[model samples]
Target: MSDILHVATRKGLVSFKRAGNEWRANAPAFIGQPVSAVLADARDGTLYAALRLGHFGVKLHRSDDAGASWSEIAAPAFPTVETPDDNAPAVDMIWTLVAGGADEPGVLWAGTTPGGLFKSSDCGATWSLNDSLWNLPERKDWAGGGYDLPGIHSVLVDPRDAKSLTVGVSTGGVWPSADGGGSWRLTGTGLRAEYMPPDLVFDLKMQDVHRLSACAAAPDIVWCQHHNGMFRSIDGGETYSEITGVKPSVFGFAVAAHPSDPNTAWFVPAIKDELRIPVDAELVVTQTSDGGKTFASQSDGLPAVSYDLVYRHGLAVDRTGSRLAMGSTTGNLWTSDDSGRRWTQIHGHLPPIAEVAFG
Candidate 1:
């Protein structure tokens, strides 16, 4: 059996395999289409790819034999607007595609741009809009973080309870639902939005969470990379505490948690808000083994003078916690088999990377 990494980019999907100590990326798939999200279910070794076609909106595909072959599935679609408005909510991108818990086999979730969360019971065959979230009175206040519409960039399903979930939106703060995706409440109590007025920074709905990762050892321990800084939550989604001591810059787009250690996690720091490139013109992945108490930049053997910016889901850790893969908006892909202590570029100059996952 070989360890594989699937990278979704602005142009297509790229697959890589571990050969000896290095990751070797293969030819691109879904050529010419922008692939936004790629996930693989370890339970059955099935791969899922989310694509964004220039003129055709969002699409999804499933591969049972790894990336060898794929079949198109029923894509997620929003219900017609009742107000006859041209600006009605429409899905322009599927920012996240996640599999449910191990016990919940065929269940899957798709987080789409314009802020819609969809669920599918039979893999990616069909979907149902979480009307509860769509009709929520608070949804009217949902705004875009940087794009023209809001998007659900992160989705976390409780490892112990598939019925409980947490979602992170661009401008809309993180929200948690105990009864699956039914009723929800904003859970950004300790998160901050420094972009707003000083007095409004702590508003429950004001935080801008760039990426969220859960510690596999403890589902409640979450690490968040935010627009302004970094944050952590030990009580699940109840509250968060800012990690104020991270070096270089506090702002970043991606965070990855150790698969079996709640206290260990990683982040890729970029320049602060308004400027989103690597700090000091060098790209580094920071790691913390004592929860969020401290962080250290690990960039040995990696590019020293670089200005690459990774997307929110561009960083991912394998189940063993011994491998790391990250791709950048500049179309550079790097991997580390020594738990991020050293890195090597396996692919480059393809297209802007949207997401990366290890399978």
Candidate 2:
């Protein structure tokens, strides 16, 4: 299990270190600033934080000596467009960040708002946008779910091959690349979108995938929390099968797949998109140990009767697959050591958490 936990919140980036049986909070970095994403790269012990400075624009920072110190790095930007009709969209926020494979040192991938993917070879020194995905003609059909424009929230790099990648866009659907994003194709079949017209219900391009997570040991076993319901993929997102009839509700924004167990995954359930709150005003994390065939509602230490909602990146499981951390928009946080059987509240108030990561 990891002894450190990093939380990106609406106010700032906060870190916690495990102290015996308790987690102690460290002096928060970027305090009072909205931290949209945080990545604790285990490859080189480097820490990265993405800040959304509203009117000031997006900014990124790197910390080599953990959270003790940090320096601003180059944030991803769109290339200048000469034609007025070909107006390139600016990056509104850095939604997610992931380090390259062990063989590729100093390489990083970033998913940003307005549906753009960027790559860096010299850490965060410079970035180049993936023009292949940006120039997709079908990109015009992609619409926004929560933000003004669609965003790529989940970027899954297959453990077996660094060149193989899968990205989850809010309203753009699932995209898989075979040649390090040199080429791309949409292939999320079996995903049903009730929000769309009946004729386009099965259209992959219209499915709103809130989050996508894959088991580390078995990268092909992927889990998805969709706007319509929960889905599972055994072939690395080429296709998915909706797992319906989950208790409470299958509508949620966050999903976490166990690092080792392909059949085991966790989801934070809510009422629905129209009513984004805990079922019966009670928060719970549902667990599926049998590949979504069955579910167990686990809510030992979470709020009994309250309104707390977890975002797309709010839930995270450590590398050990034994420790899990969950943060909420209401500023509540919890940790579970025995999978999802039981949980312990680590902190009651921090800030509106955007992402939780372990290192």
Assess the local accuracy of residue 134 in candidate 1 as a C-alpha lDDT between 0 and 100. Answer: 77
After superposition, candidate 2 runs with Cα above 4 Å error: 83-87
Per-model TM-score, in order, reads 0.97, 0.98
The lowest-lDDT stretch of 10 consecutive residues in candidate 2 is: 80-89
For residues 137-173, write the lDDT of model 1, one tens digit per residue. 8777778875678889889999899888999988788
| Per-model lDDT | 0.87, 0.93
Candidate 2 has a TM-score of 0.98
1-359: candidate 2 lDDT, tens digit per residue: 89999999999999999999999999999999999999999899999999999789999999999989999999999997787464557999999998988888998999999999999999999999999999999888888976888999999988899999998999889999999999999999999998789999998889899999999999999999999999999999999999999989999999999999999999999998678899999999999999999999998988779799999999999988889999999999899999977899888888999999997
| Among all candidates shown, the one with the greatest TM-score | 2
As a whole number from 0 to 100, the lDDT of residue 308 in candidate 2 is 93
Model 1 Cα displacement at 111 (Å)? 0.6
* lDDT score for residue 129 of model 1: 93
Best by lDDT: 2
